[model samples]
Target: MFENLKILRRAVKAVATKDPELRVQRFYLIQEPQVEFLDRSTHYMNVGFWDGDATTLDTAGEALARKLGEAAELRAGDTVLDAGFGYGDQDFLWLREREVGRITGLNITPHHVEAARARAEAEGVTDRLDFQLGSALSTSFEPESFDRVVALESAFHFHPRSAFFREAYRVLRPGGVLAVADIIPIDGATPRMAFKAGPLSFLKFSLPDENWHDGSTYAKELTEAGFADVTVESIREKVYEPWRQYMAGRVDDDEYRRKLGKALHKGVVRHWSGQDVMRQELDLLDYVIAVARKPE
Candidate 1:
């Protein structure tokens, strides 16, 4: 009962707060129930990149991280700065698969920082992966410190994403790359729909108005931030619809029902299956993988 009240209070604060980072932080803090229901195995908080052979939730999330690595042209012996590193899943993937030299992760959420640090220690990769409680918008890293900067499914909450872009440019080496897997409102999403109050009204709190831009504008932002070779490629087809289908299937499963707990299962089935609100909300979003580079 008290926990429910706490979530209610946090939700109200998230809706009312003008600070984008705080709003997003509160949203994530209140999303434990939703997160558990969505991904049962992994700590991946992304809307998975679904494609051939990436059917399950965990595999699809990993595939999304790998896709970002490919976009960044991540190479061995390159140092990486993972901004908004949720659970440090992508950092682990890059260290093991891509053989990146080292990764330093920055995140605003203390819970994520603690959890990721624990995971890093348990996995015996603390030397290569460091998770710190910090903001991507204004990092403390030195200029030209890293070879690559990446944000996986987390840049949208960066208040004004342009600030992070400029910071990325500042902290990256002369020839470093900046890669991002981000979600933004489509060009067709007008002010009304973007700020509409309804099932997905939480988006109004989580996504800043400045971040509601199309691909072209996104590329322009990167260019303005002193990045060259900017490319923002849409991959919405493989992210949203397939994820909705997978969630629909999972909500219908008895095993998932047991796993999600009774209250969350009922709520998810109600809003997700009975009303189809999730699909309606997703239709208005566009997912893109953006790649850019600092000139040598």
Candidate 2:
């Protein structure tokens, strides 16, 4: 009962602390004039996760969604799992568009859970999908389940990616495939440095994850985790180049983007030196995808 009460309090606090308008402004992706997330004055957020109370998404959020879906090889009737479910937009959107049968979504954030639930109900996929408040390191589901599991753009926020890989492998049935997608570092990402900037900041300041390395080393980890047919392939078409273009496309010209980028960098430096340090650095894993299969 005490645990349940604590859970309820956290949920209530998550919803009550910020107004919906503020959330939509910084994190929601509906940017048309008629929609809530359209205003341009909002501070930068990476595709809707709040960083320093800011609300914003890259201009290529929609395009990136399509690319992510394609990379996951989504198909109809696939029993899927979405790890690190964000606002639930990508999973919800992909499942519905692809007519996937059953999808279970898990994330650490209460705000993400609530939003994902609301959006699923709104989209009328609530019956086919289930949203749970959980973590990638440990999920609340039976083992040897799910046809495909995707950790799109959210895996790097998980520490020791090996744990998640093990969990994913455990929950996947023979012949089931697991795909991990996220902004990974090519190299030079120490546990300490990982604690500093980019997506890791969200985990450190607000959530979990203090050790996030790029998937370059994850292939060995996955192999050691007992998965077969393990391959760490780069989906360059879907990740960095597109992301750079998408975020860059929001402004009118190069000059405007440069100005905004500098301003955003200045704010990061003021609030988070870790993020400030990464302002112009490009990572080989600015976008990457890894696919492995549980032995059939």
Candidate 2, position 62, lDDT: 44
In candidate 1, stretches whose alpha carbon ends up further than 4 angstroms from where it belongs are 1-7, 33-39, 192-200, 273-277
Q: Candidate 1 lDDT, tens digit per residue, 6-124? A: 65677788778777677777887775645453655677889899989788889899999999999988899899999999888889999999999999999988888999999999999
Model 2: per-residue Cα lDDT at residue 223: 89
Task: Give the Cα lDDT of each candidate.
Answer: 0.84, 0.59
- The superposed Cα distance between candidate 1 and the true structure at residue 197, in angstroms, equals 9.8
Query: TM-score for every candidate vs. truth?
Result: 0.92, 0.66
CA-RMSD of model 2: 9.6
For residues 1-296, what per-residue lDDT tens digits would candidate 2 score against the true structure?
A: 34334433543444343443232223222221222233343222234322233223543454445555665677898888888767666776677678888889987666667877987798787888889987778876799888888886666656556788889988888888888765555553534334444433333323223334555567778888888887776555444444443344444445544644554434323433433344444443345667787888
Candidate 2 Cα errors over 4 Å, as ranges: 1-59, 189-214, 236-238, 241-280, 283-285
